[model samples]
Target: PIPGWTLERLHKGYGQALQETEVFYDSQTDHQRLRVFDNPRFGRVMTLDGVVQVTEADNFIYHEMLTHVPILAHGAARRVLIVGGGDGGMAREALRHASAEEVTMVEIDAGVVEFCKTYLPGISQGAFDDPRLNLVIDDGAAFMRNTQKKYDVIVIDSTDPVGPGEVLFTDSFYGHAKRALTEGGILVTQNGVPFVQGEELTNSMRAFKALFADWGCYLATVPTYAGGPMAFGWGTDGPGRAVTLAELEARAAAAGLSTEYYTPEVHKAAFALPGYVRRLM
Candidate 1:
């Protein structure tokens, strides 16, 4: 907030962002505008290109759901790849899986990595310093296309499909991502909230359909994001990627993952999308 001015997200046609807040830091990186603020309900909030990326209070819901759903379902994901999650939340969660021996994260902008590490350290939980993480400062789309290294699980923790993040949502990127994965590997992406951006989920599923034999999406309620439930795009060549609750619970227990938002039950329930969201598929 400056003088009488306030930053707000129109959220497509959903209406105004409801949080009343105070700006802590705001600047324009080489790629997009970044803003860090404090919301009374959500605590610390990070926004890029005028979109809320994460809030300290509700971030676990988004991070855990996006990371664990695929990792746990795959049950033997050792090598993981994360694209665009410069904040490090995805890496933090992925490392919690005992099966993960190495995690390679490719982020285009070094500024986002440093900014979040300095200002939003809680979000990453020092995952940047973990010996197992390989942090690369390079374009994510290009890295996926060129890397000879394959991953057992790949998570695309990208911002909304705008500004620098738009390329990640394209079919070409999805194709390259599929090639970057090992056999039976799983890929998950942050498709926007279907309540407001139904087309985002629809388009992502369309791309997944062209690339993977089996693909679907799941939902998680992140209070930081307005409109409604956020959809996470899922894709895999493995037809048996979706396992029963009993199988997931056993895998999670074996992994010794202690999480607030993601449990075996929640993992099973997250895929039970509402009718309106299912229509997008």
Candidate 2:
């Protein structure tokens, strides 16, 4: 362990610490305590209320899987909705697809967006300035509950199911998200690491199972997110999950995506959950 490492005590009796080489911003936002710092291995790191949110390195795994899987599977998702993700990473990836004509992101904390844009510009990569992105600084749950607008894909790039993010994991929120989707649309959420936060995945899966015809989760390994592989909840009323490998290959080719982590094969294999993670769902 490093002598002056910042400890993140997200779970009881377990924690992850990183040595901060340079602290850029550490202050309380209107919603939570937000911090941005640089680590030797992880590059720039951002945390919300003491929990790791995104790192300069390895955010590609989480952001790519969360956004591309649904968009590629849907094949023609013109309008996408992102709940939370004030850092703009989700919007960044979602807008990569030319098929996504409009990407609407609702974030509760404007401070998070501003701080990340300044401190972690590489993560969002100029997605905030894109004409296709409509950024809304508001409570994500409230927006979902009232929005009459429909999306072909909805990505819940939220924090863990705690504090302000707690409302986003409720049955009511999932119900609203389902209603906000177009026919055959897909919804994905951040369900945490199943090894430690098993209950979180199970609870979200339960809500999804009740609301959608198909519900499950996919795995992605984010080194900053400790314990084990993190799970992203998947739910939709259509055949998105059953997209053939050849079709996915064709779509990937068509999109002309230059990615570091995402591929059609990996996307398919991510859903092949291990027994321990499967048990959680």
Candidate 3:
């Protein structure tokens, strides 16, 4: 209960408090209570409804893994679809691949995008202005249900499976996302930390197992998304998951990407689930 610190009580028993060096934006949006503040260690931080969403320091780990893994694994992801990445960090990473000709990002809240652009531009880094990006402001599940256009890779960069983001974790939504993919396309989702949010990952994986020929979860240790490694749900009818390490290395070299946390080795190693997480899948 420090005077100036913002305590994020996402879990019932666990919480993280960041000392707010400067409060940037703290108010209500149409969907949730959006707060953007400056912290000494994490730099700019954005929180939605008292839960930390993204931070300047370690966003690269989340964004890079979510975008690069599927795109690079697919090896020719020309069209990408992003659901609920309003902050534009996902788009920034997806657009990094010259192979991705078009990246369509569907976000529910235009307010989140607007405020993120104004307050946390460094996280997005001019991705919203990219010519290849087709920004659509809409509900992610609805868009997936109706969109006739197929994608090589679809990333569900949504918040925790609660409130507005709850629908994104449902079996019906996973079915729609599976249908929205082109032949041999991949679908990845932001399943929460398995240690704390085990049910979330299990539910998503259950749906994925029913919908796709291949279904599993991967690990990424994001400092902000506490409780061990955060799991990204992986579901695909494609052979992307079977891609070898040598091939990934070649792709990384060809793309010539300069990343902070992602590499070909990391990409391959991410899928090796620990025993506890494996039981959830």
Poorest 10 consecutive residues by lDDT, candidate 2: 1-10
The TM-score values for the models, in the order shown, are: 0.94, 0.98, 0.99
lDDT of 2 at 160: 94
The full ranking of all candidates by TM-score, starting with the best, is 3, 2, 1
lDDT of each: 0.87, 0.94, 0.94
Per-prediction backbone clash count: 0, 0, 0
lDDT of 3 by residue, 1-281 (tens): 89989998877699889999999899998999999999999999999998999999999999999999999999999999999999999999999999999999999999999999999999889999999999999999899999999999999999998889999999999999999999999999999999999999989999999989999988999999988899999999989999999998899889988899998889999999999999988
| Candidate 2 Cα outliers beyond 4 Å, as residue runs | 1-3
Assess the local accuracy of residue 166 in candidate 1 as a C-alpha lDDT between 0 and 100.
89
Candidate 1, position 50, lDDT: 78
Candidate 3: stretches off by over 4 Å:
none
Look at candidate 2 and give me any clashing residue pairs: none
lDDT of 2 at 104: 97
